[model samples]
Target: MGTYKQQSHVVWQCNYHIVLCPKYRFRVLTGLVKDLVEHDIKMLCQWKDCEVEELSVQPDHIHLLVSIPPKVSISELMGLLKGKLAIKLFKSYPQLKQKPYWGNHFWSRGYFVNTIGLNEDMIRRYVLHQEEEDKKEETNGKHFTLFD
Candidate 1:
């Protein structure tokens, strides 16, 4: 089983592989820009209580593998990350405000996200095994009835 995190009443392991791109797919993420983006992403994830398993900042796109709590929605997390990062980047490096990024936007409008979890066959087998055990318990001689 995968390592699970726990809250007050629930335990979960929700991980996502996310891909983000710059506006118009610009190849501007280099040198200091790349470093700043990486730092900002880590900070944003930490603020939301999420863990960044892996991060790669390419020139035009980014690949992020993160483990988020059940309390946080993927959309919400993405919005926060994108919005805050754009603002921070623009403020940190005003030169980015010129050219192709005139709309005050840094990231593309949409992102790609996929879930990461155990294989379906493993889950199916565990479910079937549990049902079998339940059947055996019902067939044993220690049955009790409310009427009795």
Candidate 2:
């Protein structure tokens, strides 16, 4: 559980469950790639004064429970996370650029987010099982897009 943060005139708990995937749902998040993503996310959260309560990096997607400050908007935070990760990933693994993604974009256009309140436990469980749940889904040899 995140401790209450005291900002100018308010005491608040701003926690969220955020999930996102790579462009075209590519299963590239493995081995060193997975380690890089995890490290980058932790560093980003530390830089932004946020707390990462839980994190799961699946082959095709990422699930995170984070506590962001009240001063930041979810969209702004997501933009920073996605944008920075893309840049880092591209630089660290140049071969990734050869993949079929438009304008060097490494992630999809949108993401999934939910607020965490009293149901933090439930959210934690969900994040933990993300990989298992995804593996159970029958894609029928077809790729799925979140935006679709």
Which numbered prediction scores highest in lDDT against the true structure? 1
Worst 10 residues of 1 by lDDT: 139-148
On TM-score, the candidate that comes out on top is 1
Q: Give lDDT tens digits, candidate 2, residues 1-148.
A: 6478788898999889999999889999999999999999999988898889999999999999999988888998899999999999999998898836445989988999999776768889999998777776745534477776
Candidate 2: where are CA atoms >4 Å away? 100-103, 119-148
State the displacement of the C-alpha of residue 107, model 2, in Å, after optimal TM-score superposition: 0.3
